[model samples]
Target: MQINVNLNGTEQSHDVEPRLLLVHYIRDVAGETGTHWGCDTSNCGACVVWLDDVPVKSCTVLAVMADKHRVTTIEGLAVGGVLDPVQQGFMECHGLQCGFCTPGMMMTARWLLDHNPNPSELEIREALSGQLCRCTGYHNIVKSVQWAAAHPATVGAST
Candidate 1:
Protein backbone atom coordinates (compact mmCIF):
# COMPACT_ATOMS: atom_id res chain seq x y z
CA MET A 1 0.00 0.00 0.00
CA GLN A 2 1.14 3.49 -0.75
CA ILE A 3 0.37 5.97 1.98
CA ASN A 4 1.15 9.59 2.62
CA VAL A 5 0.99 10.93 6.16
CA ASN A 6 1.98 14.35 7.38
CA LEU A 7 4.38 13.48 10.16
CA ASN A 8 5.22 16.23 12.56
CA GLY A 9 5.25 19.18 10.20
CA THR A 10 6.60 17.20 7.25
CA GLU A 11 5.00 14.93 4.71
CA GLN A 12 5.99 11.25 4.74
CA SER A 13 5.45 8.89 1.86
CA HIS A 14 6.04 5.19 2.10
CA ASP A 15 5.08 1.92 0.50
CA VAL A 16 3.95 -0.37 3.26
CA GLU A 17 1.85 -3.43 3.90
CA PRO A 18 -1.85 -2.79 4.25
CA ARG A 19 -1.93 -4.35 7.68
CA LEU A 20 1.04 -2.45 9.00
CA LEU A 21 0.22 -0.72 12.27
CA LEU A 22 0.67 3.04 12.34
CA VAL A 23 3.21 2.66 15.12
CA HIS A 24 5.42 0.50 12.94
CA TYR A 25 5.05 2.89 10.02
CA ILE A 26 6.08 5.81 12.19
CA ARG A 27 9.03 4.05 13.78
CA ASP A 28 10.23 1.62 11.11
CA VAL A 29 9.27 3.40 7.92
CA ALA A 30 9.60 7.02 8.97
CA GLY A 31 12.44 6.36 11.41
CA GLU A 32 10.70 8.21 14.22
CA THR A 33 11.66 6.05 17.16
CA GLY A 34 10.27 8.43 19.73
CA THR A 35 6.83 6.84 19.49
CA HIS A 36 7.46 3.68 21.45
CA TRP A 37 6.02 0.32 20.53
CA GLY A 38 4.56 -1.29 23.60
CA CYS A 39 1.73 -3.61 24.66
CA ASP A 40 0.58 -5.14 21.42
CA THR A 41 -2.88 -5.37 22.93
CA SER A 42 -3.09 -1.57 23.11
CA ASN A 43 -3.41 -1.70 26.89
CA CYS A 44 -0.50 0.67 27.27
CA GLY A 45 -0.53 4.19 25.89
CA ALA A 46 3.09 4.00 24.80
CA CYS A 47 1.95 3.93 21.17
CA VAL A 48 -0.12 7.09 21.39
CA VAL A 49 0.29 9.80 18.74
CA TRP A 50 -1.72 12.64 17.33
CA LEU A 51 -3.84 11.53 14.42
CA ASP A 52 -5.11 14.66 12.70
CA ASP A 53 -4.58 16.61 15.93
CA VAL A 54 -6.27 14.07 18.19
CA PRO A 55 -4.24 11.56 20.12
CA VAL A 56 -4.86 7.90 19.35
CA LYS A 57 -3.05 4.72 20.14
CA SER A 58 -1.16 3.88 16.99
CA CYS A 59 -1.04 0.21 17.93
CA THR A 60 -4.75 -0.05 17.17
CA VAL A 61 -4.71 2.05 14.02
CA LEU A 62 -3.65 0.77 10.60
CA ALA A 63 -1.05 2.75 8.76
CA VAL A 64 -3.28 2.87 5.70
CA MET A 65 -5.96 4.46 7.84
CA ALA A 66 -3.51 7.25 8.48
CA ASP A 67 -3.02 7.82 4.78
CA LYS A 68 -3.47 11.47 3.86
CA HIS A 69 -3.79 12.26 7.54
CA ARG A 70 -1.57 14.27 9.83
CA VAL A 71 0.36 12.29 12.42
CA THR A 72 2.27 13.95 15.22
CA THR A 73 4.68 11.76 17.08
CA ILE A 74 6.61 12.76 20.16
CA GLU A 75 9.23 14.18 17.85
CA GLY A 76 6.68 16.77 16.75
CA LEU A 77 6.41 18.40 20.14
CA ALA A 78 9.42 20.59 19.68
CA VAL A 79 9.44 23.36 17.11
CA GLY A 80 12.53 25.17 15.79
CA GLY A 81 14.74 23.55 18.45
CA VAL A 82 12.80 24.78 21.48
CA LEU A 83 11.28 22.03 23.56
CA ASP A 84 7.52 22.04 24.06
CA PRO A 85 6.50 22.94 27.57
CA VAL A 86 5.38 19.36 28.22
CA GLN A 87 8.79 18.11 27.17
CA GLN A 88 10.49 20.66 29.38
CA GLY A 89 8.10 19.88 32.23
CA PHE A 90 9.11 16.25 32.22
CA MET A 91 12.68 17.29 32.70
CA GLU A 92 12.02 19.96 35.31
CA CYS A 93 9.72 17.76 37.37
CA HIS A 94 11.38 14.39 36.78
CA GLY A 95 8.24 12.96 35.21
CA LEU A 96 10.02 9.97 33.64
CA GLN A 97 11.97 7.12 35.18
CA CYS A 98 12.43 4.15 32.85
CA GLY A 99 11.87 6.48 29.88
CA PHE A 100 9.81 3.91 27.98
CA CYS A 101 6.47 5.67 28.45
CA THR A 102 7.75 9.21 28.48
CA PRO A 103 7.06 9.93 24.84
CA GLY A 104 3.43 8.88 24.89
CA MET A 105 2.80 10.47 28.25
CA MET A 106 4.16 13.73 26.95
CA MET A 107 2.08 13.38 23.80
CA THR A 108 -1.09 12.98 25.82
CA ALA A 109 -0.02 15.68 28.19
CA ARG A 110 0.43 18.09 25.32
CA TRP A 111 -3.02 17.21 24.01
CA LEU A 112 -4.61 17.74 27.38
CA LEU A 113 -2.91 21.06 27.86
CA ASP A 114 -3.88 22.20 24.39
CA HIS A 115 -7.55 21.52 25.03
CA ASN A 116 -7.49 22.44 28.66
CA PRO A 117 -4.68 24.85 29.27
CA ASN A 118 -4.78 24.51 33.03
CA PRO A 119 -5.85 21.08 34.13
CA SER A 120 -6.20 20.39 37.80
CA GLU A 121 -4.36 17.48 39.35
CA LEU A 122 -7.44 15.32 39.18
CA GLU A 123 -8.10 16.28 35.60
CA ILE A 124 -4.46 15.68 34.74
CA ARG A 125 -4.66 12.29 36.41
CA GLU A 126 -7.82 11.51 34.47
CA ALA A 127 -6.24 12.58 31.21
CA LEU A 128 -3.24 10.35 31.74
CA SER A 129 -5.16 7.43 33.23
CA GLY A 130 -4.85 5.47 29.98
CA GLN A 131 -1.05 5.72 30.04
CA LEU A 132 0.79 3.31 32.31
CA CYS A 133 4.12 4.05 33.88
CA ARG A 134 5.85 1.47 36.05
CA CYS A 135 8.09 4.11 37.45
CA THR A 136 7.42 7.46 39.23
CA GLY A 137 3.91 6.31 40.25
CA TYR A 138 2.47 9.40 38.44
CA HIS A 139 3.15 11.80 41.29
CA ASN A 140 5.82 13.57 39.33
CA ILE A 141 3.98 13.01 36.11
CA VAL A 142 1.03 15.04 37.37
CA LYS A 143 3.47 17.62 38.58
CA SER A 144 5.06 17.61 35.18
CA VAL A 145 1.77 18.41 33.50
CA GLN A 146 1.23 21.18 36.00
CA TRP A 147 4.64 22.52 35.24
CA ALA A 148 3.82 22.54 31.55
CA ALA A 149 0.49 24.23 32.20
CA ALA A 150 2.33 26.94 34.05
CA HIS A 151 5.17 27.30 31.59
CA PRO A 152 3.33 26.89 28.29
CA ALA A 153 5.63 27.29 25.25
CA THR A 154 7.85 30.28 24.62
CA VAL A 155 11.17 30.95 22.97
CA GLY A 156 13.81 31.27 25.66
CA ALA A 157 16.62 29.33 27.27
CA SER A 158 16.69 25.67 26.25
CA THR A 159 18.00 22.56 28.03
Candidate 2:
Protein backbone atom coordinates (compact mmCIF):
# COMPACT_ATOMS: atom_id res chain seq x y z
CA MET A 1 0.00 0.00 0.00
CA GLN A 2 1.06 3.56 -0.66
CA ILE A 3 0.71 6.06 2.16
CA ASN A 4 1.08 9.79 2.25
CA VAL A 5 1.62 11.54 5.53
CA ASN A 6 2.35 15.13 6.46
CA LEU A 7 5.28 14.30 8.65
CA ASN A 8 6.67 17.06 10.77
CA GLY A 9 5.24 19.58 8.32
CA THR A 10 6.83 17.82 5.35
CA GLU A 11 4.79 15.66 3.02
CA GLN A 12 6.07 12.11 2.73
CA SER A 13 4.85 9.38 0.41
CA HIS A 14 6.02 5.80 0.40
CA ASP A 15 5.02 2.29 -0.63
CA VAL A 16 4.78 -0.13 2.25
CA GLU A 17 2.95 -3.23 3.33
CA PRO A 18 -0.64 -2.78 4.42
CA ARG A 19 0.15 -3.84 7.99
CA LEU A 20 3.35 -1.82 8.37
CA LEU A 21 3.42 -0.03 11.68
CA LEU A 22 3.54 3.75 11.76
CA VAL A 23 6.72 3.63 13.83
CA HIS A 24 8.49 1.64 11.13
CA TYR A 25 7.21 4.01 8.45
CA ILE A 26 8.42 7.03 10.33
CA ARG A 27 11.83 5.49 10.94
CA ASP A 28 12.44 3.15 8.03
CA VAL A 29 10.68 4.88 5.14
CA ALA A 30 10.24 8.48 6.26
CA GLY A 31 13.80 8.40 7.69
CA GLU A 32 12.88 10.12 10.91
CA THR A 33 14.45 8.45 13.96
CA GLY A 34 13.27 10.71 16.73
CA THR A 35 10.18 8.63 17.33
CA HIS A 36 11.43 5.53 19.08
CA TRP A 37 10.06 2.03 18.56
CA GLY A 38 9.57 0.34 21.90
CA CYS A 39 7.28 -2.15 23.60
CA ASP A 40 5.45 -3.31 20.49
CA THR A 41 2.36 -3.91 22.62
CA SER A 42 2.09 -0.15 23.23
CA ASN A 43 2.82 -0.57 26.93
CA CYS A 44 5.71 1.86 26.60
CA GLY A 45 4.93 5.31 25.30
CA ALA A 46 8.25 5.45 23.48
CA CYS A 47 6.54 5.30 20.11
CA VAL A 48 3.99 8.01 20.75
CA VAL A 49 3.48 10.58 17.99
CA TRP A 50 0.83 13.09 17.19
CA LEU A 51 -1.56 12.23 14.40
CA ASP A 52 -3.52 15.29 13.33
CA ASP A 53 -2.62 16.99 16.62
CA VAL A 54 -3.65 14.06 18.79
CA PRO A 55 -1.04 11.78 20.36
CA VAL A 56 -1.20 8.09 19.48
CA LYS A 57 1.07 5.13 20.02
CA SER A 58 2.69 4.61 16.67
CA CYS A 59 3.33 0.94 17.32
CA THR A 60 -0.40 0.39 17.68
CA VAL A 61 -1.30 2.28 14.50
CA LEU A 62 -0.72 1.14 10.96
CA ALA A 63 1.04 3.42 8.51
CA VAL A 64 -1.99 3.23 6.21
CA MET A 65 -4.10 4.59 9.00
CA ALA A 66 -1.97 7.74 8.96
CA ASP A 67 -2.43 8.36 5.26
CA LYS A 68 -3.27 11.97 4.41
CA HIS A 69 -2.82 12.91 8.05
CA ARG A 70 -0.33 15.08 9.87
CA VAL A 71 2.23 13.22 12.01
CA THR A 72 4.45 15.08 14.40
CA THR A 73 7.51 13.32 15.79
CA ILE A 74 10.03 14.58 18.27
CA GLU A 75 12.05 15.95 15.38
CA GLY A 76 9.19 18.36 14.71
CA LEU A 77 8.87 19.65 18.24
CA ALA A 78 11.20 22.57 17.63
CA VAL A 79 10.25 25.55 15.49
CA GLY A 80 12.96 26.96 13.24
CA GLY A 81 15.66 26.63 15.93
CA VAL A 82 13.59 27.47 19.00
CA LEU A 83 12.73 24.48 21.14
CA ASP A 84 9.14 23.90 22.17
CA PRO A 85 8.38 24.91 25.73
CA VAL A 86 8.06 21.22 26.60
CA GLN A 87 11.53 20.49 25.31
CA GLN A 88 12.88 23.47 27.15
CA GLY A 89 11.05 22.40 30.27
CA PHE A 90 12.59 18.94 30.14
CA MET A 91 16.05 20.38 29.91
CA GLU A 92 15.55 23.14 32.47
CA CYS A 93 14.07 20.78 35.03
CA HIS A 94 16.39 17.85 34.30
CA GLY A 95 13.35 15.80 33.46
CA LEU A 96 15.17 13.13 31.50
CA GLN A 97 17.68 10.67 32.86
CA CYS A 98 18.19 7.88 30.30
CA GLY A 99 16.47 9.87 27.51
CA PHE A 100 14.43 6.91 26.23
CA CYS A 101 10.96 8.15 27.13
CA THR A 102 11.72 11.83 26.58
CA PRO A 103 10.13 12.14 23.19
CA GLY A 104 6.75 10.67 24.10
CA MET A 105 6.70 12.47 27.41
CA MET A 106 7.48 15.72 25.66
CA MET A 107 4.85 15.16 23.01
CA THR A 108 2.20 14.34 25.61
CA ALA A 109 3.32 17.30 27.71
CA ARG A 110 3.05 19.64 24.73
CA TRP A 111 -0.46 18.43 24.02
CA LEU A 112 -1.42 18.85 27.62
CA LEU A 113 -0.02 22.37 27.80
CA ASP A 114 -1.60 23.34 24.50
CA HIS A 115 -4.96 22.25 25.84
CA ASN A 116 -4.47 23.34 29.44
CA PRO A 117 -1.83 25.99 29.82
CA ASN A 118 -1.90 25.95 33.58
CA PRO A 119 -2.18 22.29 34.48
CA SER A 120 -1.75 21.58 38.15
CA GLU A 121 0.84 19.11 39.36
CA LEU A 122 -1.84 16.47 39.68
CA GLU A 123 -3.07 17.27 36.22
CA ILE A 124 0.44 17.02 34.84
CA ARG A 125 0.90 13.67 36.53
CA GLU A 126 -2.39 12.41 35.18
CA ALA A 127 -1.65 13.56 31.66
CA LEU A 128 1.70 11.77 31.61
CA SER A 129 0.53 8.68 33.43
CA GLY A 130 0.57 6.55 30.31
CA GLN A 131 4.23 7.13 29.51
CA LEU A 132 6.64 5.08 31.59
CA CYS A 133 10.14 6.23 32.49
CA ARG A 134 12.17 3.52 34.18
CA CYS A 135 15.10 5.75 35.01
CA THR A 136 13.58 8.59 36.96
CA GLY A 137 11.04 8.56 39.75
CA TYR A 138 8.92 11.03 37.73
CA HIS A 139 9.55 13.91 40.09
CA ASN A 140 11.52 15.98 37.58
CA ILE A 141 9.19 14.97 34.79
CA VAL A 142 6.29 16.54 36.60
CA LYS A 143 8.46 19.57 37.29
CA SER A 144 9.30 19.72 33.60
CA VAL A 145 5.65 19.91 32.60
CA GLN A 146 5.11 22.49 35.30
CA TRP A 147 8.02 24.48 33.97
CA ALA A 148 6.48 24.40 30.53
CA ALA A 149 3.20 25.58 31.96
CA ALA A 150 4.85 28.52 33.69
CA HIS A 151 7.08 29.35 30.75
CA PRO A 152 4.65 29.33 27.87
CA ALA A 153 6.03 30.87 24.67
CA THR A 154 5.26 31.22 21.00
CA VAL A 155 7.12 28.24 19.61
CA GLY A 156 6.22 28.19 15.93
CA ALA A 157 6.26 24.37 16.00
CA SER A 158 3.25 22.43 14.71
CA THR A 159 1.37 19.84 16.71
- How many backbone clashes does every candidate have? 0, 0
- List of clashing residue pairs for candidate 1: none
Error of 1 at 139 (Å): 0.4
lDDT of 1 by residue, 64-158 (tens): 99999999888888877888888898899999889999999988998898789888999999999998997755999999989999997552212
lDDT (tens digit, per residue) of candidate 2 on 20-73? 999999999989999988889988898999999999999999999999999999
Where is the poorest 10-residue window by lDDT in model 2?
150-159
Worst 10 residues of 1 by lDDT: 150-159
Candidate 2 wrongly placed segments (more than 4 Å): none
